[model samples]
Target: MRFLPILLSAAILAAPASAALKDEAGITEGLIVVGIAYEISRVCPDIDARRLRGLSYLLSLKSAARQMGYSPAEIEAFIDDKAEKRKLEAVARDRLAGMGAVRGDVAGHCAVGRTEVARDTNIGRLLAPR
Candidate 1:
């Protein structure tokens, strides 16, 4: 009987983890992180260089996101949506940079820190695998 309580608690905890993501929108944060990692790879062919830059960029973005009024959930959704739409990344990047090559639509709205995070991550080390 004592174990019943423990089992119930475990089930409750696990339920949220298992069901946290019911759709693509639910997992956007992860997508953003992954996309940043990919961008890092593209920028730096060397692992060591990418690792430091990627970590710094991620740290800055996370801090900025917290300061910005976006819940972690919203950031994730935005990242996922952008990653899924290939053109969105390019458009968003230009918009954020203010180069205006693309319309000030996607990037304009992106938090500057978030855009920097994507642009700054270096993935050469990430691709090499420890």
Candidate 2:
């Protein structure tokens, strides 16, 4: 899968809404491309791109949440919720002091890595494996 579409989508999202008619299509297409690329890479380690790209995406989300005035308690709630889904997200508050440096796309890389791990072993297998 190609990721050009994802980057294109980001560009379209960056564009003004009034002038988005033509660019919207490309943006949509780019996102699809990026998603496909991400999935393909997740299934095949040999093709996975650098993990940093995914890390950047995660950081962006955290930044957005911060801008939205999420309180410390609120952020703690979020961390608690995410901890069940991802162990690393449950890091101690003290350890998170410098977590601002963590990129957003780290989630993507984590997802891909998890997928690869699941594929290689039954570590995360449910009651049954389909």
RMSD per candidate (Å) reads: 14.5, 15.9
Q: What is the TM-score of each candidate against the true structure?
A: 0.32, 0.31
lDDT per model vs. reference: 0.35, 0.34
lDDT of 2 by residue, 1-130 (tens): 2223343233222311222121333322322323433443444334554334543543444355456565434433443332221322222111222322122344543454455446742111211112
| TM-score of candidate 2 to 2 decimals | 0.31
Predicted model with the maximum TM-score: 1
Clashing pairs in model 1? 28-76, 29-76, 40-121, 40-122, 40-123, 41-123, 47-124, 47-125
Residue 118 accuracy (lDDT) in model 1:
49
Encode model 1's per-residue lDDT on 18-98: one tens digit a residue: 122323332333323434344333333332123444445545554455565555555444334322335334433433345
Model 1 misplaced regions, further than 4 Å: 1-49, 82-85, 92-130
RMSD of 1: 14.5
